[model samples]
Target: MTTRTRTTTVTWSQANARRLDRQSLGGSGSPALGVTEAVAAMLGAHAQVLSAAELAVGVRAPGVTRAEVRSALWTDRSLVKTFGPRGTVHLLPAAELPMWTGALSAVPGEAARLPGDARMTPEQVEAVVTAVAEALTGAELTVDELSDEVIARTGPWAGDPVMPAFQGMWPRWRQALHLAGHRGVLRYAPNRGRKATYTNPGTVPLPGPQATHALVRRYLHAYGPATPAHFARWLGAPRGWAGQLFEGLAAAGAIEEVTFEGVGAAWVAAGDTAFPRSGPRGVRLLPYFDAFAIASMPRDRLFPGAAGDRALAGGQAGNFPVLLVDGTVAGVWHQRRSGKRIAVTVEPLAALGGGRVRELERRVARLGEVLEGTAELTVGAVTVGGHA
Candidate 1:
């Protein structure tokens, strides 16, 4: 007679996937900035500010300073401010911004909608369009060059001061660029002219019929097991459009779908492994808008109670840099310096201890050198409440 025993293997949750992004991307995944360079590729062209956000979002680490941003130049993930989607400055992967920008503007007249809150008329958009067409008639130019040409031709092209102004134009412009990226019209290239410049994709090939399909596939590889709704939010596309991209990829055998607890697991790559079961816990000093908290479309799964209020606190602004402990969003963090030294103030939902505490401090110390001055740290009370 024989007796039987039962055993089970557990997989990680969507929440765990977020943490995996950190490990996979943080300097381990890509060597040239190589694979990791994909981080910039996925986000499109980014700015230091957005890079900070990228860290918060788990695409990169936070407390990164301007010097560090500049350090990314050349390699694979350098800072190239190409105009796409919203004519905004995105701190994107230097290599892929062109494809991304081209995809965003794929269809003709696609950029006509939204335009801006000012709602520039078609004629107005056309004027700007004409200016762009003329400027890129032969070759690509840097944002400064592009702006110079545009302003020289039309007086002012809107994004004068940069940063904040550019942040606003992402609606229509981003859509246009996203569509354009799908078609391969524009591509990223080394500028040599102080800043990197973007030129016409000039006959490079991109994924076919599955245009958005190819793009979204990368999204999953980088930020997957996500829902259509979440895809829609991150890519800045409509839910229906997101669904189309999702299905297109799945249909093409580009990805695999699994149903998990929250929002129902949705999609991932063909051979990707679900995370291994997470154990007790730990602490992490993540950046604002960090992916750990904001990866999913709904935003509620990981941050159950107050994700909405806290994330939107800056006026529907965006997520702040977050702190994590034991597989959940713990709170937020701020990095300050006293002249030659750096300090990290972490506010947590619970008092972090032992391993988690030491771990966060080490991570912060490493990030600090990659940030301001000499490396240093200072913890603020460890409030068990949350982001105070």
Candidate 2:
């Protein structure tokens, strides 16, 4: 078993964070690359960004106007980017998508490593993908319904629609989605449906693993102060396989390990980059799944609840957009849309000053633009300020 090294010191904290896993949601892993630079790299060097609301913070910035980032993830790759570095679906960079997904492909039964019946053969698999892609040309379907339809059609590799043969195949079903996803042939319905539904992959073959490793390395660089264990969890790859692959990459000098606290992890340097520090400037408004929020899986090390809150409450599911005052969750924000009007209300758990309130308003306004509407931002008082 790999050992753990513990180092607790203020001076080394920043570098230490880089040693951990990375979240590929918003930008690159390197603080060195600004938003635009990372976005460009993630979207195949030249890609379109999207305009969406309350996407996860760093993973799904509502502000991204690039179409390639949004539409393609659903349509071609079928895999969504997220912060599994700590179990959140943070934004995943497009280039790195295939490896993250392909790795997931081999994680199930050992049979995954071998070939199966005709229906499960490579030819059959491609046919299933084609038929599913054809079916979802302009519609959405839940996995249950889509898999059933694909199985019944008798197109390429054929299978019985309602037989025991089709039970417990979410991963297989997910593979179809991935095929469709890599092809830019599917997308998720907004707010998602009762079940996860997919749209069409407009056109294009998907990325592969070589691309994924490249992308993930950059993600860790920017969101450093993380670990390899964290990345293994995030990529959803087998620990055994990932180590071998990552180690090979490291040996070739493709990756490096950052050390602190007597321990080190595989890492890529994000030189000359710095996250906003908490000091006289004590707060930052964070989007849900924001890099800062999920940067470290065990967040207590950085957040207010480091030693107490047993259950992890803040992430893609549990927490919404937040108000971070002094590097901790100071409050939460609720965003609502009425046609072209966006309303933002902050429920502060503590007090605040006027300048901070104004700054928040400005931040919200930027969010409104990304959300594509006018906005009204309100900051409630904390104990020193007021109450909810």
- Per-residue lDDT tens digits for candidate 1, residues 282-358, read 45565544433444444554454554444345432234566655555566667666776876776665666777677
lDDT of 1: 0.51
- Local distance difference test values of all predictions, in order: 0.51, 0.47
Model 1 segments more than 4 A misplaced: 1-15, 18-69, 74-79, 83-88, 107-127, 136-148, 151-210, 279-281, 291-293, 306-318, 381-388
Best by TM-score: 1
Candidate 1's TM-score reads: 0.67
Would you estimate the TM-scores of all the predictions? 0.67, 0.58
State the weakest 10-residue window (summed lDDT) of model 2.
Answer: 44-53
- Model number with the top lDDT: 1
